[model samples]
Target: MKRNSRLSLALHALSHMAFNTDQPHTSADIAAHAGTNPVVVRRVLGKLREAGLLTSERGHSGGWRLARAPRDITLADVYLALEESLVASPSETEQDMCSVEHALAIRVSTIMNDVEASLIERLSRTTIADVRHAAQ
Candidate 1:
């Protein structure tokens, strides 16, 4: 399934932080590395911050750092923090007239939910540190 770049970006930034735990990374720095806008980076990282995965500081020398150790953060954590589902489920608003379409949509939605649950379970098995180690 095709997923949004936000998850990729989040994982990338976290992997960098995993290597350099002592230093903070700015949104601009991460954006440059990911080849995206700083604003987009901020928006993505902002969600991480709210989820307690990362912490942000203000001022010239200030930036973002991991709130928890890389080993303590799972891929599932990042995925859930971003709050975007990889599975394309049926829309909530359905056409009431078509019973066949409605039944199909319900079944598909149930299957998608199951797929998402499986995805989360699999992701929870791998931590950000695991990803960093794999990259090395």
Candidate 2:
């Protein structure tokens, strides 16, 4: 299934902030590291900030910083902050469907819901700190 890239994008931006506690990172700087645009970085991290996971500053020498410690932020937190799902079922189509097709959609939706729940459970188990450690 096609997944939204925002989750990974947010995680990447957060990792940069986590590693550089001594200094806040500019959107331009993170954009460079993430290989994306500054606006994209801003938009993604903007969600993180709204979720209380990070903070943003304005003016010269201003940038982005974590609101709390890396250990305090989970993958689930970042994922949810982006408001995207890991397992996405197909969108409902307007075309008329047979009874069997309707039944199958129901079953698939149930399974997809379960899969998403499990994925979220697993994501809750790991924090950004864990990811940082693993990356080292």
Candidate 3:
């Protein structure tokens, strides 16, 4: 499966917030840093807020801040908050019953499952703290 840019952007935002814990960041600021639209940043941050990873405020002093410490937030946390399917595979929509295609489908499913497991496992090991430090 292809890497989702949305997921990467969410991670970047979270890492930025973690690294700058003393101050809140606006969507516009994050958008500029990530080189994306503010609306996209806001929507992604909204989901992160819902996942208890970040918090947002309104009004003149309104912005976003990390809900917890950088070490407390994992890449898996962001991925889960975004509700993304880590791995997507082709569905056997076409008829393959009683044919070699059936075996191919099973093999594909098994391979995809393995890949998904590895990906999630690796992602879980890296926290926002890790990204923040690495970016420095």
User: In every candidate, how many clashes are there?
Assistant: 0, 0, 0
TM-score of each: 0.93, 0.91, 0.87
Model 3, runs deviating above 4 Å:
1-4, 94-98
Query: Compared with the true structure, what per-residue lDDT tens digits does model 2 show for residues 1-136?
Result: 2223788778888877788787889999988887888999899899989999999889899999999999999998988888878687968773666788888888999999999999888999999899888888
Superposition error at 105 for model 1 (Å): 1.1
lDDT of 3 at 21: 94
**Residue-wise lDDT of candidate 1 within 31-78, one digit each (tens)?**
888888999999999999999999999999999999999999999999
Candidate 3 least-lDDT 10 residues: 90-99
> What are the RMSDs of all candidates, in order?
1.7, 2.3, 2.3
Query: After superposing candidate 2, which stretches have Cα over 4 Å from the reference?
Result: 1-4, 93-95
